[model samples]
Target: MGVGEFSYRISISTLIVVFPLLFVFRLAQGQLHVVGSLQPVVAGPGDDVILPCQVEPAFNVAGLTVEWSKPDLRPDPNDRLSRVDYVHLYRDAHEVPDMKLPSYIGRTALFTDSLREGNISLRITNVTQEDEGRYRCFIPKLKSQTRFSIVRLIVDPSLTETVTTKAQLDPENFHVPDLNEEIDNKGGSSERCRLIPVVVLCVFILLCFAVGGCLITESQKAELKKRPI
Candidate 1:
C-alpha cells in the first residue's frame, strides 16, 4: 500500500474508534443524573416515611454519596425556603462532623450511604405536620464525582402529624350530622357553663339574706325584752 493510503486508513480507523468512545461517555454521563422514587407518598402519623431514590447510571456508582433535604417554609426565596432549598445535608461522605443536628432536624432520620444498591432512601421517623413538603435527594457517583439533582416530594400536609390524637381533628373539614344539632350542642355547653355559676350565686345570696333576717329578729326580741315591752 502507498504511504498516504496507509496513513489515511489508519486515521479513519482512529476516528471511528474515538467517536464511538466519546459518544458512549456522553451517553453514560447524560443518564448519570439523580432520580427519586414516587413521591406525594402517604403515611399515617408517627410512622416512618422512607424516601427512596437511585442514580440513573447505577452499577458504575462507586463510592457514592447522598444528601437528603426537606423543603422548609422560609422567608428567603431561591434560598430553599422561599423558592429554593430550605433544609439539606451533604450526608454520607461530607456529613458535617461538628454540627450533627440540623436546624430543621425534628423527628427525622436520614440515610445517605445507601446508593450502592441504588438505595438513596431516608427514613423519617415520627413524621409530623411540618414534614409535609418536597424532600430532595441528591446523589453522585463519588468515583466519577459527577453529581446531579433528584426529584421533588410533594406530600400532603397531614403527613406531618406525629402525636397520637383521640381522632384527627381537622376543623377545616368539620362535618355535622345536622346543622341544628351542632348548634344545640354548642348552645348547651355554653348555657351549662354560664347558668351553673349564676344559680350558685343566687343560692348563696338567698342563704345570706335568710341568716341576716334571723339575726335581725333575734336582736329585736332581745331589745324588746330589755325594754320590758
Candidate 2:
C-alpha cells in the first residue's frame, strides 16, 4: 500500500479502539454526530457561542459531509437529501439528512466558510434559556467513515447576554522592533560596504612603497661606490 493508505489504516485501527468509549459518552448525553463531536459550547441566554467543528490532523479532506441535529432524531435512510428547520423557520428537519449532522441547529448556526474542509460546528446565536440542552456535531468523510462529539449547553437564567467575536474573524498581532536597534543594524551594514574599498586602497599603497624603497636603496649604494669614500 502507498504511504497515504498505510497511514490511514494505522490511524483507523487506533481510532476504532477508542471510538466505542467516546460514542458511549454521547449516549449519556442526548447527542449524536457523524464524523466528529462539538465541544460543550457555553453562552449566556440569548448570546451566541461558535463551536469549533474541525477534523484532527487536517487530511486531504475533500467531498466530506457535515450537518447538525438533536439526539434520537436521525434522518430517514430513504432520502439522499434532507431539509433542516434552521434553514426554514421552526419546522422539523426530518426532511433533511440527520445521520451526518449535529443536534440543535434550530437555534444554532454553522460556519459555512468552506464546507470542503469539514468544519461542521454550529454557532448558536441569540441563545435562549430553553437551548440549555445537549448539542452534537457529526461529520462523514466516507460512506463507512464518521466521527461524533457532543456539547452540553448551559444558560444562566438571570444574566444579560453579549455578542462574541467570531474566532475566525480575529486580527493578527504583528511585532515591532526597537528604534535604536533598528538604526544600528542599518549603520553596520553600510560601514561594511564602505570598508571594502578602503582596505583595497591601503593594500595598493603598501605595494607601491615597497617598490619605491628598493629603487632608492640601489641608488644610494651606487653613489657610495662612485665617491670612493
Candidate 2 local Cα displacement, residue 57, angstroms: 1.8
Cα lDDT tens digits, model 1, 106-196, are: 5444444454555555566665555666555544334322233223333345555543222122232221122222211211112233244
Clashes of each: 9, 25
**lDDT of prediction 2:** 0.44
TM-score of 1: 0.43
**Clash count, candidate 1:** 9
Query: lDDT of each structure?
Result: 0.45, 0.44
**Clashes in model 1: which pairs?**
77-82, 78-83, 80-84, 80-85, 80-86, 128-160, 128-161, 129-160, 129-161
Estimate the TM-score of every prediction.
0.43, 0.39
- Best-matching candidate per lDDT: 1
Residues 57-175, model 2: lDDT tens digits: 33322344444444434446687585332221111312242323343445544555544454555666776676665544444333222244444566776666778622341112111
Off by over 4 Å in 2: 1-39, 59-62, 72-107, 141-146, 165-229
